[model samples]
Target: MFDWLQHIADWLVYDVFNLSTEQHLANALNFFIYDTVKILILLFVIIFFMGIVNSYFPVDKVKNYLSRHKLYGLEYLMASLFGVVTPFCSCSSVPLFIGFVRGGIPLGVTFAFLITSPLVNEVAIGLFIGLFGLKTTLIYIVSGILLGTISGVILQHLKLERYLTPWVKDVLAQAQREQHLFEAEQLAFKQRLPIIWAEVKKILKGVIPYVVLGIAVGGLMHGYIPEGFFEKYMSKDNLFAVPVATILSVPMYSNASGILPVVQVLVSKGIPLGTAIAFMMGVVGLSLPEAMLLKKVMSLKLIAVFFGIVTLCIIISGYVFNVIL
Candidate 1:
């Protein structure tokens, strides 16, 4: 499917620049150009498609639906799946997380969405397809959903509502007093195009930097890094590799768009796929920036507990992937 992109990269590297295939710089530049264009195209298409979905079923509607419906235990699953389609990064998802809470969604359910949104979404799905192919992407999506659902359910059972800050308590009380507001008047499909297009552009604008930086970092690694360099630390033989990678990644932050290409490079360098993926999940899902944003709504203890559950889930997932893949 991406054969044409490879052709373009080869032409630019060899024909236009007149660099030989043996040159590392040529290989790096080729990797960058091919991946950049391919990922951008994939991201643009998926974001625009999701934008239309979001417009039809706006945030207000989703909030109301989840708040009203019991959905049995599946509410957690629903929230996690919703997180997959939404394009918000870790920090960005927190505001919506607050919205869900204020709208009376279960705190654990919101946690499911919050945990998954950053780790897997439209942008992440697209990049995963590009970097790891369909099979791995499907596994990743399922694992993300499961991780969020499991974390949310466990947190819900903990009865941690009191752990919320006083400000959030007030917000929740105010929301209870307010009446439900229905959607605005519907517009023609043609009228909605502009709004959706604007959203598509907005999403692309926000994530493009991450994509480019990630791919650039990946290209350098691809071209110049010695094979098996990372394997020494993260290879499958190392039982603790997954946990170490997951823990090390917590301090770093990047959305899926930025971190996925680097993940691709890690896999190429012989790091166990599970370990690399676990590191990527930690960076995106358990980022320090996300914790800072959560501080506004949740107490420090609540945030710590949330991070703890997610960290454990990610580590488990990493090990599972290493064994299977």
Candidate 2:
């Protein structure tokens, strides 16, 4: 199906520019061209459909279900699953987090949703399948959901409600008293087009720079990195490799789609599959931008705890995959 697209890229690079694909510079340019076109096309189609689905599912209903449930295990599970479909970026996820907290949802359950939303975005899943195949894609999805669910359940058990920011506690208390409810507004079918278009534009604007940067870095790594660089340092036999990858991923700002190309190159160059996957998850699931955004509503201590727990889980997952795979 994609043969024609590859032909077009090849034609432009080889025929038009007279550049040989065997050259490192030409290879990098071809990588950039193919990935940019493919990702942008996927982004537009998937995000547009996601917008339509999101519009149909009113936030009030979502909040009500999540908040009213006291069944901790079930709620966490549901929140993690719900996150798979929501596909929110880090900044947008914050408002939903606030609403969840305000609606009296447990912090842990809300955190579950927050963790999975970006990690389990449809675009990421689709790209993973395309780039890494089905088994790896399933591993990513299942592990991502499990991470969110387990982290949320642990936080709930620890009774960490007191660790929230003072303002968040105040808001929650006020919400409990006032019991403000969200009323669902039904929009006409035609009205939905503009909403979807706006969302598509907003999403594209936010992600384009990261996508470009990620592809550029990936292109360079694909073309120019020494073949044995990762094999020497990040092989499965290196006990510290998983931990290092997990730690490095936390501060990275790129989304899963942005970083997958580089990860592909890393794995092709002989980085352990588990280590590469761990790094990809870290970048997508936890980031400096996400922490800064969450800071508005969470105490610094709580943020630290959240980051620590997630990092630990990712490291464990990496090691397990390394041993098993």
Candidate 3:
């Protein structure tokens, strides 16, 4: 199947399209444009439905149910599982975080949701399945959720609630200010569709540039990078590969969906699956943007702690996958 697809790809580029050196460059440009357009369309449809779900459902109910303080482990599991179904990015997760905080959910459980939401989203899962097959995708999903739950429970045990910014705490305290704001606004579902559409537009405006840049870079690396370069740096035999990948991925920002294709190429070139997976997770979950955004609600100390915990989790997950797979 892959050979057939590659044959078609070659025919289109080398025969019908007659791509020369200059044409290859143009084709690359066109690839980026097409990729950006496709990703924007997908994001719009997915987020529109998510917005409707957010508006119609009582998010407070989930918060309240999870806040009862009965079973920390179970609550963490549920939070992580919930994240798998919800399609939210770091920015989108903020409002839900605020709602969870205002609804009196435990700080640790809320952190679980925050961690899992970006790391193990449906789009990421689908892309993984398509690129890497079911086994690898399942490993990614399971490890991500495990990391979220474990990190949340650990943070709760540390009692680091005091590290939150004072203003954020105040926002939680003033929860009644906008309670029922959505419920009181009476609009038919059809009428509400436009609002969701507008949100999709705004989000795409912000996200498209990053997606374009990331994919273009990935395509260049895919087409031109030396096959053995990543293999030499990130082979299973290299003890330092996992941690190195995690550290290198910190400044970079791409979700799993954006990184999966690049990762497929890396694996084909003999890069260890564990190292590639760790790099992908770090890019999505521990980005500079996420850290900066989190600073609005947390002190530098808390942000540092969050990064450290996630980095450690990714490293450990890498090693585990290396051993098992």
Stretches of candidate 1 above 4 Å error? 1-70, 177-233
Stretches of candidate 2 off by over 4 Å are: 1-72, 176-237
Kindly indicate the candidate among 2 and 3 with the higher TM-score: 3
lDDT per residue for candidate 1 within 87-138, as digits (tens), equals: 7667657656765665556789999999999888887898899888899999
Candidate with maximal TM-score: 3
User: Residue 161 in model 3: shift from native, Å?
Assistant: 0.9
Each candidate: RMSD: 8.6, 8.2, 7.4
lDDT sort, best first: 1, 2, 3
TM-score of every candidate relative to the true structure? 0.64, 0.63, 0.65
Q: How many residue pairs clash in each candidate?
A: 0, 0, 0
Q: 1-325, model 3: which lDDT tens digit per residue?
A: 1244445555666677677645545455444444444445555655555556655654465556656546738988898898878776554455466546545567888889988987898888888888878998888888999999999999888888899888556654433322344568867787767765665565456555555565566445334443334445677667899998888777555556667777788788777888888877776777665565556568999889888988998899988987887
- Candidate order by decreasing TM-score: 3, 1, 2
Candidate 3 positional error at 8, Å: 31
Tell me the deviation in Å of residue 155 in model 3: 1.0
- What lDDT, from 0 to 1, does candidate 2 have? 0.71
Alpha-carbon runs more than 4 Å astray in model 3: 1-69, 176-232
